[model samples]
Target: MTINFDKMFTFSQPGRRVFGFGTISRVGKEARSLAGGPRAQVITDSKLMELGLVEPVIEALKAAGLETEVWAGVAGEPTQGLIEECRKDIENFAPDVFVGFGGGSSIDVAKIVAGLMTNPKDLHDYFMKDLGVGRFENPSKPLLAVPTTAGTGAENTWLAITSLDDVEGKVGFADPKIIPPRALVDPGLTMALPPGITASTGIDALTHILEPYLNANTNPFTEALALQAVRIVPVFLPRAFKDGKEKEARFQMMMQATLGGLTLNYGGVSEGHLIGQMVGGRYHIPHGVSQGIALPYCLRYSLDIFPEGLANLANWWGIDISGLDIKEAGLELIKASVDLLKELGMPWNLRQIEGVNRDDLPEMASAIATQPYFITTAASCCRKINTEKDYLWILERMYEGNFLD
Candidate 1:
């Protein structure tokens, strides 16, 4: 790959990160250091609570001599109303620090709650509107993110995604102030994940890695992290998927997710995420599963315009492109990605998803084209999206699981 030193880009991540098999043990100590007082709240979901994952975290906080409260209400993709209800529910606690524990949705709820705790406005006030980005006037309460899933990279990113029923889509609140200051990534937390969750979240991490690497906003810092993550996913994701107790695979996947989070923070996601967000909110599909279904089709769309980047991805996937042209190499990469999804037992097409009828493609395409987030990502896409027709073209291929010819 050729270097482009003149291209300007920026990078940032959480102030502190502790990653290992037993890093969850240190959360209390880390929390104490970042907390302003003795009160700490853990934001998670009912499922995690039922799994007894939140107890250790609570015990850790109490062991650190902090007064802890658990609000286990976050479920599925967080909605605007859910955020409001969570903020209202925890209003009396007035936590000095927050621990976001669980998957992306839970962590995102924590972020929004923390960000809105001190600020006077509602979460909607800070949502990305059209081309203009919203800014948070006040810094959020100190937050520590502990991710159980190896996808979404919500722990490190400055954005919080929420679904809005009014828009029938998802929107994000983007601000540097809301990014978690500390993270404890313990792969041990994921050892009990079911195969389906493992497969979907693993593919989600790969999508996060690839979009940033392939987009126009990529820089040296993001490229290094993204490519390393790319290599890790193809090897270890399957191991982790087949055997959730594979410690080594789990550890590597945790690292890959964290790295992918950083890339996602700086380089940003493009077409796949744009489409994923749309379909995910509309059909209530798991975020990672939606991203998996969109991955290869979106890459095929990008391949027509930016073969060089996709070719590099093909090389990293261990494809022998010695005798192939750029297009051929890109196609091989797409094939490899699709094959990986199949191997992991992911849905190969939009039609395979429940409630996603063939007739819904046009409406979905229109919604995607006009969505502010999609508009923002379109600028970074390899191929210029000229109209709803462009999105429709990709949607059509995705519906049929058609390979690029």
Candidate 2:
């Protein structure tokens, strides 16, 4: 409900989106229209390759009469080294069009590689940091994202996240030129996702929606997309998790993820992502699981600041908030999110993640406080997180899994 009217904001998304069941068949046709030459490249992960998902995309590209190369090297979170490696492999191939055909990681690699191909800069220069000199001087090759998962919303957003191993943190390239001009979102592609992935990614999508919607830096356009996507998560996420073949559930979740990405483009994320990125980068936790663990705690931290927004969220989830004060209703919303995390079999505390310990909290808190991206985006959070102590307070609660307290 809170909007910053002092400064103007801009909203953007991919130029075109094709969604529905069996839309993968149209990738060939779409690629033909976007291609400047006969060469095309598909960036994805080896897991998807083993699962037999990458072949269909390659076949689609080849069917359109294009010479295609497959880079199935993307694994785990994208790193600066990985991006450079992918860039080296493809710089010589020089594809006129790119098909990012997997989860967020693969799509992110595709986006960064496409950008580097045209912009002649080290991947580190584009990192979202104080000293980062990333500026795309030329337009990137046309990219078409094909999201096989219903979580990351990477297919629709321009930002590409990468891990900085030496710093034990994550950063992104925030440039409009890196945004995919077209996307193919087919729920059918996610049919083979295991229950664990279904749950984690679904929770990841929820974090993306909640952070932007609840943040002070939001607009009518962002709120509408976020609200719609938020409603779908409670109803459909469980169904999709319980049965991966649930067609309607998968379809709705995929739609929610795409909309969540759109909200990120306009609204952006805040504290939850900041903490999640840091912990995930330091401990090698899965991105969605890290976000899922931090989401309710972050919401609770900001509850008093966004009572009306939280109350509205409770109503959307069909919770009866009659006769309750706005703060109480907000607490109910936070409890619901925690409950959903439990239902999805996600970790409820930071301690549950491997490589995380009580001693690491101070270092993690300090890293978040000093991180350039966090420092810039912290102003947009409903609750101010200005110092190491502020971050430590939240991190302590997260470590102990203390929700109400």
Candidate 3:
């Protein structure tokens, strides 16, 4: 197998340390102090509110002498107009700080709004072609990212992924100015998660690790995060799902999720993320399920062309992968990945996503061609594929249902 030296490695430095528990008491205190103001705005979903997830956070802020306005309009994947709406609402509260208090989508929206509210220009001004508009030349307001789910690492990273009405995959544009001034992770927040959601988000973090590790630009630093994430999920994910109150399982999952986000801060994302986003948006698949569905197939397809990289990944997972020949090890990784998905109850084929069919493969493949991560991560030397064929091939295997030898 050949590895490209020029495209070999990328370096990344994480922005902040993580503090975790099951409560929101400390978040408000830290956020108010950091914002240096009395007014704090929270962005979260209605479902979280109904679950009483944000109550402790609100009370904490109130006790800390911080007035708050909760924006409960965020749901589904984030969009541009939603950001504008959030910007308008904050004016009423005149909040000096923004708190992202939910899952990846909610936190991502809050992160962008905080930056845009403080920075100049229209939200789209900094899009792909806008030369210098979105650059984080100056810091924005004090923003605190508190995760309700162990996902997206929005707490620890600067990248905000939002969907466009006209676009297919989530368009990601990152600026250092957008990184939250502080990130507070409390695993207690995830204690109420249903088994299905626990399975999906855990797998999503797993995918983030797998993606960066598989990128042609795989770095020694990223490799560590990816391997640890891989190791943690298989061991702790089931426990977290089986009993959401298990502090040990929940704590490690949160840390693993944060690590995955930090590791991918600069290192590239793989075809799995790119293709998963495509599959999710077009078919209404959730992010975590999309990650679980696309990742193993992507790794399996890339194995033959990148055997040396695959070996490194196998070693990172601490499997006795060397016992088999390189080619055999590569195939074993695919089997192991599929096994992980089954453990999580993830769907393997497009058909598993209600309403998906053979006819939809062309559209889905076409959609993946337009994904955002493709620009930064696609390897010119990686295996060239008739993506439509791969799309159909995966579905075929998925339809087979049980494990493939």
Model 2: per-residue lDDT, tens digit, 251-284?
9999889888988888788788888888887788
Model 3 agreement with the true structure over 205-275: per-residue lDDT tens digits: 88777776666656667667776776678889989988999999999998888877877774657667767
List the candidates' TM-scores in order.
0.96, 0.96, 0.89
* lDDT of candidates 1 onward, in order: 0.85, 0.84, 0.72
Q: After superposition, how far is residue 313 of candidate 2 from its true place, in Å?
A: 0.9
Extract clashing residue pairs from model 2.
Answer: none
Question: For all candidates, what are the clash counts?
Answer: 0, 0, 1
Backbone clash pairs in model 3 (N, Cα, C under 3 Å; residues 3+ apart or in different chains), count:
1
What lDDT does candidate 3 reach at residue 217? 55
After superposition, candidate 2 runs with Cα above 4 Å error: 131-133, 164-168, 380-385
Q: Any runs in candidate 3 off by more than 4 Å, and if so which?
A: 1-14, 129-138, 166-169, 315-322, 370-373, 376-405
By summed lDDT, the worst window of 10 consecutive residues in model 2 runs over: 126-135
- What's the lDDT of the predicted structure labeled candidate 3? 0.72
Report residue 328 deviation for candidate 3 (angstroms).
1.0
